[model samples]
Target chain A: MKFTVQVNEGPYQHQAADSAYQFTKAVLEKGHEVFRVFFYHDGVNNATNLTTPPQDDRHVVNRWSELAKEHDLDLVVCVAAAQRRGIVDEGEAKRNSKDAENIADGFRISGLGQLIEAGIQSDRVVVFGD
Target chain B: MSEEMMDDEVVKKMAYINRRAPYGSIYALESLEVVLIGAAFDQDVSLIFADDGVFQLKKDQETAGIDMKNFSPTYRALEMYDVEKLYVSKESMTERGLSEDDLVVDVEIKTDAELADLLDDQDVIFSF
Candidate 1:
């Protein structure tokens, strides 16, 4: 089955990102297709490349990037949400004249239309959040 | 498969789960916004109001003092969008000392088990 996953909270601060990652990984391991993993609300924090966690802590941002690379996954961060929280891509940073871009590898910033398209195309849409 | 079978495929069951109260945070209102936008897709949609989420449908919500827009009236307009499958958790309402009379809209009250059964049949569940 094709599934679309949505995460609604930030990484580290909440268990939502971890659960969403685990769920996505498990589904892929079971030979199911993940159509897209949409990061909305504070969930867009998962796509920032600037987070520098303690040495012992899991690198949540890198984990998502690697997973997407391994499975050829579509990791989408909501543009509206990302902008609100200052998670920007190269183009956005350039457009807004910011010094740097913080979007992680393997994640693309898009509109809510992508989310709606996922709902239309996927067999199931599962959400993880507080 | 026959062309007729392919063309007449069944629509996926979509469930919108609400577990937060309105006004305190943006979840309840944002969830409602998604539901309203999703109505245009014509999918099989159902809504679940659980935990403090039951407060979202409470009657006579006064937002004037808080300086926030009171969106309780949107619940009544849901029917116009053909999005009528609203379910409220009986346990949640009882714990909060609220009855159907306190809600602004009519809803089918179900126990956790019953609600679970309903959710099990859904193809998709968007929890807010």
Candidate 2:
């Protein structure tokens, strides 16, 4: 089965991101294909490299990066939502004249078209949101 | 498959389920953005307004005091994008003391059971 997952809330403040990650990992373990993971609204916060948790705690951003690396996953953050929330990539930083880019590894910023395309292509679209 | 092939052959019934109020959270706005973009895909689309989401289509929304851009007018323009299937939960409207006349756009009102049947027919359901 091919699946596209959407996370619509920020980490820590809500459990949606964590649940989405767990669900994605479990789906892969079960030999199902993950077509894409789309982060929108506050969920874009999960793709920021600036996120740093205590040494004893799990790093939500890094967890996603590591999972993407292991599975060669496509982690997409909606560009419009990212820009609204200040989650800038190197290209976006340069385009918007910002001083820094905070997009974490294994993630790319794109338009909402990607989300629609995922819905069209994937067998199922699962949303973990608040 | 080639991009053109996918475009020509693939069509899905996509439903945008809105349950949030218009102003307090960003879900309503974010969902609207997705609906607008999804319009370009030429999929069978339906917009379901339930709970406080019915308020999003309320006529004469004034956001000046809140300093937010009043985007209620966009609902009326949705038809221009060929996104004309708009439905509201009958119970939600009644609970809010709103009627069809209160809305900016014309829409079909469905009971909870009917709404469930409608959603069950969708290929994809986007919850907001």
Candidate 3:
């Protein structure tokens, strides 16, 4: 089945992001397909492209990016949420004339419509937030 | 594309709203895990972050001072897991002197009216 998962909590605040990550892995292991991921609220931080964890850390950012790349998932960062938090892509950074860009790899910038669309298309739409 | 072309039938919608801060608590994280498990079962999930919940997404968070490993940096890693439908109330943001620029993620900053409309559309709503 096609699953659309939405996570609003960014990394490090709590284990919500990690749990969501594990759940996705399990879903794929069970032979399920993930249609897309819509990050909003604090969740958009999950797409920041630049992050370095210490040697003793879990490297959560890298892990999520790896999962997206491995599964070819559409990691979507909400456009309004991202721009406000200074999480921008190459194009957005240039357009906004922002010196800093934070959106992570394997993630794209999109609108809330993508999320609503996901809810309408996927057999299931799961959300992890707050 | 317009929603008109999408599936007309209303599917089961599940939401896990996280209303906690990033560094000073654990409830927000634990609740998210349960929601993900539920989502794995083919449930429709949506997340709403109101109040201080917006702080959970700031960049460069370190927990060394609190003698706890700062986990705020983990917010950006939700994509591999596909949990992306996140929402925040505009009123909440404004109440706390926050705007779209204060959060780490891109969220739907809707008015109470819009949230009410969205909530009404949900077949089921769960708050945490």
Candidate 4:
């Protein structure tokens, strides 16, 4: 089955992001296709490349990036939410005249329409949030 | 796509899992918007009220003091949109001391295990 995962909370602050990541990993391991992982609300924070966690902690952002890279997954961060939370890609940074870009690897910032499209295309859409 | 074309597509079971109260945040209201718009796409949709989400269906909500519009009435319009499958968590209601009488809409009250079964039947689950 093709599944789209929606994450609606920031990492560490809530278990939503972690649950979403684990769920996605589990789906992929089961040989199911993850159509896309759409991040909305505070979940957009997962796309920031600027996060620097301590050595012992599991790097949630890096985990998502690595997973996406390994599975050729489409990781989408909502543009409206990302802009509000300061998670900007190179294009958005240049367009908005921002000093630096912060979007992490393997994630693309897009509109909410991508979310709706995911729902339309995927066989199942599961959300993890607060 | 045109409405006629949309009607030809396979209908998927989708549920909007409301887990928060109204006015506290934007999730409740936004989820409602999605449900409204999604109904037009001709999918089999339902709303699941769990945790603090049951608070969103409480009757006699007045937002005058908070300066926010009272959207409780919007739930009433859900039926008109053909989006009437509403389920409330009995455990959540009991936990919050809320009964069916407190709710604005008539809903099927389900236990946690039954709700889990219903969730398992869904093709899509949107939590907000």
Candidate 5:
């Protein structure tokens, strides 16, 4: 089955992001296809490369990046939500005239239409939020 | 499913479930953003306001003191976008001491059981 996963909380501050990651990884391991992983609200925080956890702790942002690379996943951060939360990519930073971009690897900024499209294209839409 | 076999213009029954208050959290506003954008997809959409979410549609919201943008007016424009199916939880409204007359827009007041049946009929359920 194909699934679209939505994560609605930031990393470290809440368990929603971690749970979403684990769920995505588990489903991929079971050979289920992930149509997309949409980051909305505080979930856009998971796409920031500026995140740095303690050496002993798991790096949630990096984990998602690596997983996306391994699985060829589509990790989309909602543009409106990301703009409000200050998660910017090179294109967004340039367009907004910001000095730097902090969006991590394996993620792209997009509109909510992508979320709706995922819901239409996928077999199921699983959401992890507060 | 095969790529070529899937129709490019497939429509699905998508429901956006709002269970949070209008303020103190970003869920309600962001959920509204999704609903507005989801309108462009031409899917069968339903907006269900339950719990504190019913507060979002309360009429005459004064956000000047809170220093927040009052987006309640957008509810009234949903019909212009063809997103006219709005449902409010009757139990949630009664629990909050609110009535249908207090809302900014006209909506179908449904009981919890009726809301459950409505959700069961959706192809996708988005919770916020």
Candidate 6:
């Protein structure tokens, strides 16, 4: 089966992120294909690249990047939501003359169209949120 | 193979809003899991977070400080599970003295009014 999953919360302070990941992993482990993964709300901050956890902490950013690459997934971060929290991609970083590109790799910085498209394109639209 | 297979099924958009930190309790994570179960069957899904919910994305967080499990890392694995739409409120980040640099993953940020607009778009909303 194919699934479109949307995550609207982060992993740190929000358990929604972890729950969402587990659900996605379970679906794929069950041999399901994920059509798209859209990030929004506080979930948008999931794309930020400048996270350095404590030595003992779980490295969520690295994990997300790995999953995206391994699964050939489309990680779409809403551009409007991303920039509002300072999650800038290479283009936005350069455009704003910011010293950093906080957006993560293997993810597309895009609009809500991708989300709506996912809704229209997937067999199931599962949300892991709060 | 195609999304159209579920077109005949009713589609409703549900937004899950996370408005707290990563630790201190399970108020946010557990609540979200309950909803994912529903999304698995029927309904479209959207997740949103405002206010303190933005803190949930901070990178490299150790719940040891609060005697909790470090679950933030689990978020990165969400894509593999097929849950990928994450949102944070722009105003919340600003008020919390955080920037995208402070976060640990990929996300979308919106302002107060925009958040409201998104809530309007959803058929159901859950907040933590």
- Calculate DockQ per candidate and list them: 0.31, 0.72, 0.09, 0.27, 0.75, 0.04
RMSD values, in order shown? 3.3, 1.8, 13.1, 4.6, 1.2, 15.1
Query: Which residue runs does candidate 6 get wrong by more than 4 Å?
Result: B1-128
Give the per-residue Cα lDDT of candidate 1 at A117. Answer: 64
Q: Model 6 residue B77 lDDT?
A: 63
Q: Taking the tens digit of each residue's C-alpha lDDT, what string does model 5 give over A59-87?
A: 99999999999999999999999999999
Alpha carbon lDDT at A22, candidate 6: 75
- Which scores better on TM-score, 1 or 3? 1
Please give the TM-score of chain B in predicted model 2: 0.94
Q: Is the docking of candidate 2 incorrect, acceptable, medium or high quality?
A: medium
- After superposing candidate 3 on the true structure, give the runs of residues whose Cα lies further than 4 Å from its correct spot: B1-128
Please give, for residues A1-130, the per-residue lDDT of candidate 3 as tens digits. 7788878687888677888788888998899989888777677777776767678988777787899889898888878778766789988989989887777778899776676567666766777864
Q: Count the backbone clashes (under 3 Å) in each candidate.
A: 0, 0, 39, 0, 0, 45
For model 1 chain B, give the 10-residue run with minimal summed lDDT. B1-10
**In DockQ, how does model 5 score against the reference complex?**
0.75
For B12-126, candidate 5 gives per-residue lDDT tens digits of 8889999999999989999999999889888899999999999999999999999999999999999998999999999999999999999999999999999999999999999
User: Which window of ten consecutive residues has the lowest lDDT sum in model 2 chain A?
Assistant: A115-124
Q: Give the candidate order by descending DockQ.
A: 5, 2, 1, 4, 3, 6
- Residues B7-101 of candidate 1 have per-residue lDDT tens digits of 43446688998999898787887788778877877779999999999999999999999998999999999999999999999999999999999
Which has the greatest lDDT?
2
- Which regions of candidate 4 are displaced past 4 Å? A90-101, B1-8, B64-70, B77-81, B89-120
lDDT of 2 by residue, A1-130 (tens): 8899999999988999999999999999999999999999999999999998999998999999999999999999999999999999999999999999999999999999999999988889999997
Per-residue lDDT tens digits of candidate 6, residues A1-130? 7788778787596887777777877887899999888887678777777878898988777677888898888888877667767888888888879997877778888876666556656666777765
Candidate 1 error regions (>4 Å): A90-101, B1-10, B64-67
